[model samples]
Target: MKNLVILGAGTAGTMMANHLVSKLPKKDWKIHIVDQFKTHYYQPGFLFLPFDIYTEEQVKKVGKKFIPKGVNYIQQRIEKIDAENNLVDLENGTLSYDILIIATGSKIAPDEVEGMMSEEWKKSIFDFYTYEGALALRNKLRDWQGGKLVVHITEMPIKCPVAPLEFAFLADSYFKKKKIRDKVEITYVTPLSGAFTKEFCSKSLGYLLEEKNIKLVTDFAIERVDFENNKIIDYIDKEVGYDLLVTVPTNMGDEVIERSCLGDDLNFVPTHPNTLQSLENENIFVIGDATNVPASKAGSVAHFQAETLTDNILLYIDNKPLKEEFDGHANCFIETGNNKALLIDFNYKQEPVTGTFPFSGIGPLKLLKESIFNHWGKLAFRWIYWNMLLKGISIPFVSRNMSLKGKNINN
Candidate 1:
């Protein structure tokens, strides 16, 4: 019998398990999935957790519940990857595989920045990227009087790149609802030149900061956190004081990748941009935040990649040429708060432009424009994520490849 192993049972890994379970011959092969935790989190909800938008129960569910019946769900710590021997060392045992899928996703490495993991962490300084951090921040914001609320991003390639912006927007709405809007000074700090890297998006979405009265600090590469002084010092000696600091720290892949010597400087595995195959080994496939694929590290991106990867894995098993099909497609909803959101659909070749989506000029969902309908779509996605996305059920009309037919592309 042949063995197929998946390293992480997160979004990408779970989707692949569901996609391949029926396709692969059950009599000839066994499938196994490895993850340390028993609970699966809807990571996007982390952005809402701090503002009391979602309750704790809504964000997490049993990990084993979503895993397919035929697949082996091993809930244990992964010690290291023996890539040379095609073996994964777990806490209690080791598994060998004929084909390996690395879905071990990225995580916040706050210690990467000096003073970031200091004593004040989760007190004065907090992060919304993790469940613990979000809950802690939620508690902190519950009864606290308002002051300077700085939402900052440490570097690029972070998961859900637009999330910090969403947090800032939501905080504005949250404070307003609490009747403390006048007391809170919201500042958005980023190393990027603008809220968005794409010129079109930057130009189009620039009004959000001004409209919300949120301060924007651009190109400030932080040197360290001055927790004692309640400020962050940037490289050029620029300092931004904060009464409360909510930051997205340096994002890197799991340490097991570093232990296995299979990842780059950031511990992200080198991967073929189109095929989703690890550049180091064709037998090893990568998806989601694990691969250095230049795609946004968002669940929607993982959902799109899953469809393409399922087909490629079958091709790999058949000894056929794999298709270079994944085009960095990502569809996301930007929550602008106040019961409004903006939708964006793009691939490697296209930046987001204003138009209709899922249809040519007839979309009920508008791209690059804020609307209550879009906000509903964003909220509705939580249901879609649990019932459909993880089960490898295809979403209606939203193909894996991004369509330019509906977009108002200027180039």
Candidate 2:
């Protein structure tokens, strides 16, 4: 039997496993999936946790539950990858593979920044990226009377790039609901020159920040965190003081990629932008936050990539050319305050434009525009993620490659 090893049973890995298992013949292929954690986190839900919009039970489930019956699920820490021998080193033993898939997504590195993991970490400085971090921040917000609440991004390429902005907007609404809007000051600090990486979206989001009375600090690369003084210093010595700091630290790929010497400076594996194949090895495939692709490191991107990646893997096995290409397509829901949200869809070639989606002028969801229906769609995605997405089911009207049919290119 030919062994197929998949590292990390996270969103990307789990989806790929389910997709491949149903397609590959059981008599010929043996699939093994490895992950350190048993619980699967609904990462996006972390954004709503602090606002009391979602409970703990709503965002977590057994990782093994989503894995298909035909796949071998191994829960263990990865030690390293011996690419020369096509072997994966685990904490306990080594597993040899005919083909390997690395989907061990990105993670927040608090220690990368000076004083970020200091004694004041949970007390005043918090992160909403992890489950524990979200829960802690939720508790902190419950009692925070009102002060400078700074929502800062340490760098770009962080998972769910728009999450910090969503947090800032949600904080505006959360405090208002608590009757403390007048008592709090919200500021959004980022390394980028604008509110977002994309030009059109950034302009629209920047206006929202202004309208919401949230201060926008752009091109401010963080140098260190002064926990003692409750301040964050930028590389140019510009300091922003805060009573509470919610930061998305420097996100890096798993350390195993570094040990394998198959990744970039950030430990993200170098991948073909179109094919999703590892630039270092033809037998290896990469997806999601693990690859150094220019796409947004969001779940939607992963879900989109999985379809193309799965097809390419089959082609590779048959000694056929990889015909499917990932277009860096990504769709995201930006939750603004007060039961409204904005939707944006784009690919590598195009920035988000103003128009209807799926069908021109007939979308239940609009692009780059805020609406109540968009907010409901964002909330409804949780159910879709759990029931349909992870199971390799295709979402209607959403193709693997992005379609510009409904977009207003004039924008």
Candidate 3:
């Protein structure tokens, strides 16, 4: 039987496994998925954990629970990928495959930043990208008595690019609810010149930061963290002081990609932007945070890519050309605060525009605008993620390719 191996059981790998298992014939092929961890984290929920919006139980479930029955799930650490031999080296044994899918995903490398992993880490310096970091920050914020709370991003292409901004907005709301808004000074620091990658979204989000009284410090590339002084120093020696530093550190792909020489400077595998095929090896496919595609590394992007990637994999097996292409379609819900959220939908060609989604002129969700219904939709996504997304069920009206039918092109 032909063997199909998928690395990592995260969002991309799990969805791809489910998609392929249903499509690929059982009599001809066998699917196997490998992951190191047992628990699959609802990473988006990590943003709400510090704010006590989601409990630990709400964000975690067994990795195997989502993996389909037809697929063999192996839980083990990956040693390296022998691409030349079409084999994978695991800590326990070796596995061979006719086709391979690398979806190991990216991780925050706090240690890569100078002094970021110092004594202050989890004490004064905290991150919300991980479960432990979120829980630790929750404890710190429990009695934080009004001081400089700096929400910083170390670098770009981090998973859920909007999460840090959401954290900043939610923190503003959280302190206001606690009657400490006037006492707490919030600052958002990023390497980018604006609030976000796209100019339209940046301008819109920047206004929100100003309106909320959260200071915006852009174009500040961090050089080091001065834990002793509770400061973050940029390349030019300009420092931002903070009593509590909530940071998103340098994110890198799995080390196995690096060891196999299959990745770029940041360890992200170089991939064809439209095809989702590894540039180095066509037989290998990559999705989610693993690829060096100039797209937001959010769950929505992965969900969209899975649709096209699954189709391409089938084509490759049949010696057929990949017909489907991913347009970097990404839709994100920006939780602005106080029961209001903003939704932005865009693709590789289009920056987020002001309009409605799924239908023109009329929508339950509006783009680049805040509303209570959008907030409810954001909360409802958790249910969709568990019940529908992981099961590889196609979302109606949302295509793999981005549609401009509802977008206001003039904007």
Best by lDDT: 1
Cα RMSDs, all models: 0.8, 0.8, 0.8
For candidate 3, list the clashing residue pairs, or say none: none
What TM-score number comes out for model 3? 0.99
52-123 per-residue lDDT for model 1 (tens digits): 989999999998999999999999999998988989999999999999999999999999888989999999
- Candidate 2 global CA lDDT score: 0.93
Overlapping backbone residue pairs in candidate 3 total 0
Whichever of 2 and 3 has more lDDT, that candidate is 2
* Pairs in steric clash, model 2: none
Q: Residue-wise lDDT of candidate 2 within 1-411, one digit each (tens)?
A: 999899999999999999999888899999999999989999999999998999999999998999999999999999999999999999999999999999999999999999999999989999999999999999999999999999999997899999999999999999999999999999999999898889988876668988899999999999999999999998889999999999999999999999999999999999998999999998899999999999999999999999999989899999999965899999888999799999999889899988898888899789988999999989999998999888888899998888988889986
Once fitted onto the true fold, the runs of candidate 3 whose alpha carbons sit more than 4 angstroms away are none
Off by over 4 Å in 2: none
TM-score, candidate 2, is 0.99
lDDT tens readout by residue for model 3, 1-411? 999999999999999999999899899999999999999998999999999999999999998999999999999999999999999999999999999999999999999889999998999999999999999999889889889999999999899988999999999999999999999999999999998878888876678988999999999999999999999999999899999999999999999999999999899999999999999887899999999999999988999999999999999999999964899999899899998999999888899988898788888789989999899989999998998888898888888788897888896
Report, for every candidate in turn, its global Cα lDDT versus the true structure: 0.94, 0.93, 0.93
Candidate 3 whole-model C-alpha lDDT, 0 to 1: 0.93
